[model samples]
Target chain A: EAGVTQFPSHSVIEKGQTVTLRCDPISGHDNLYWYRRVMGKEIKFLLHFVKESKQDESGMPNNRFLAERTGGTYSTLKVQPAELEDSGVYFCASSQGHWTGELFFGEGSRLTVL
Target chain B: GIQVEQSPPDLILQEGANSTLRCNFSDSVNNLQWFHQNPWGQLINLFYIPSGTKQNGRLSATTVATERYSLLYISSSQTTDSGVYFCAVGDSNAGKSTFGDGTTLTVKP
Candidate 1:
């Protein structure tokens, strides 16, 4: 089966600009998640979605960051007025509805905000 | 939020050598997973071991939930084994995990 896939493997944007990263999860998977890792930092959870609704988004850094799962098949994370510290690798992962399985992750989209 | 810490932030070993990586968490977890991120930046799940032990090929992992720790064993390491190992812990119900900083492993041939 095809694993989770992310678009625009790399993104470069000026500070204060807006950028969006997309992720297409595994077929039939009901759980989708977004995570990010800044340089020299651990990978941190951003949000979780079950189907088309968000399950938990407590990890969202701020209001400038937004994540949405449309139609429950794919997800998109957008950063508005991006700051230099927003540069990092954003990863998308998915698993079954039960959420007991290992998370299948994408190669990650590296965002560079200058 | 729970706290996760990994030991030996970095490691370097020759091919054919064995190494152990440790992870300690501050609270109880119902879900624990091991992941390997290759140099290309793909995070591949190695094990979903919350307790007990599991083995896959030359790599194995053991999670002592009672002690709130886990260990990943790499035997007969190879150049291809070079990457970052991350330990993630969370509850099975929520599926939101907090990850450790990871152990960067470099295997030299």
Candidate 2:
């Protein structure tokens, strides 16, 4: 089985620009999630998805960040008008919905907003 | 929301040495996982030990959900083991995983 894979391993953009990161989860996995970590900070949960439906998105930072999982296959996280504080590593993960308690994570996309 | 804390924020060991890392959570958790983040920022899953104990080669992990804590042990550590070890737990109530700050290990040859 293929592990979670992320696109654009690294992204650099100016403040106020927009960027979108993509994730292709393991096939047949129904639970997908997004997480991020700023420099020297613990990784923080961003959201969770059960199929194409968002199960929980309370951890999202603000309105500027948006996520979508179309057809419950892959996911995309978009950041509009990004800020300097948005510079961090964004990771996507997925797991089988059977409470197997295992989540496969992507390599992560490093975002640097100058 | 749960709080996950890892101890021994940083550790330095020589190759072949052994080390233990601890993780404490604020509440009950149904799932706990250990991950190794390489220098290049790739997270490699080490264990999905929610309870009991599991061993894989030179690495082992135990998560006592009853005590709300977990432990990771690395025996005969190698230079390839130099990286950050993270502990993440998923609360039964929230269904979301919270991660600790992680333990940075440096193994010198």
Candidate 3:
């Protein structure tokens, strides 16, 4: 089975620009997650989706960031008016289910907001 | 939210040496996992050892739930082991995993 796949291995945008990162989870996986790691910081969870519905979004950084999973498949994270601090690696992962802790992660999308 | 701590923020070792990295949690009930982040920034799941001991070749891990700590042992470490190792814990009731700052291991050949 294919692992989780992320689009645009790297991206660069102006501070006020908008960027969207996409993730394709493994086939038949019902749980999807979004996480990010800023420079010199630990990777932090952004949100989670079970099918097309959000299971938890407690870790979303702010209102400028939005994530969506449509048709219970691919997911997209959009950052509006990106800040310099938003430059980092955004990773997406998936698991067979929520109860399982074994996560398969993607290569990550490196976002550089200048 | 529970606090997760990893020891030895950074480590440098010879290729043939063995090393043990530690992770401690302030509180936990269920589920603990370890992952290695490569230079390319891919997070690879190494183990899901919430309790007891598990071994996979040269990499082994043990978690003592009673003591709220976990240990990752890399025997005969290789240059391929150079990366950041992270520990994450998930609360049984909460279902979300809390991640540690991670230990950066550099293995020189």
Ranking by DockQ: 1, 2, 3
- Please list the C-alpha lDDT of all candidates, in the order they appear: 0.92, 0.93, 0.91
In the predicted model 2, the residue pairs found to clash are: none
Model 1 chain B poorest 10 in a row by lDDT: B89-98
C-alpha lDDT of residue A77 in model 3? 96
Worst 10 residues of 2 chain A by lDDT: A95-104
Clash list (residue pairs), candidate 1:
none
DockQ of each: 0.73, 0.71, 0.65
lDDT of 2 at A65: 99
Residue-level lDDT tens digits of model 2 in A4-84: 999989999999999999999999999999999898589999999999999889999999999999999999999998999
C-alpha lDDT (0 to 100) for residue B49 of candidate 2: 89
Q: Which candidate achieves the best lDDT against the true structure? A: 2
Which one wins by DockQ: 1 or 3?
A: 1
Interface RMSD of each candidate, angstroms, one decimal: 1.4, 1.5, 1.5
lDDT per residue for candidate 3 within A1-114, as digits (tens), equals 788999989999999999999999999998898989999599898898989999899999999999999999999999998999999999998878554457778999999999
Model 1, position A2, has a per-residue lDDT of 87
TM-score of chain A of 3: 0.96
What does the lDDT come to for candidate 1? 0.92
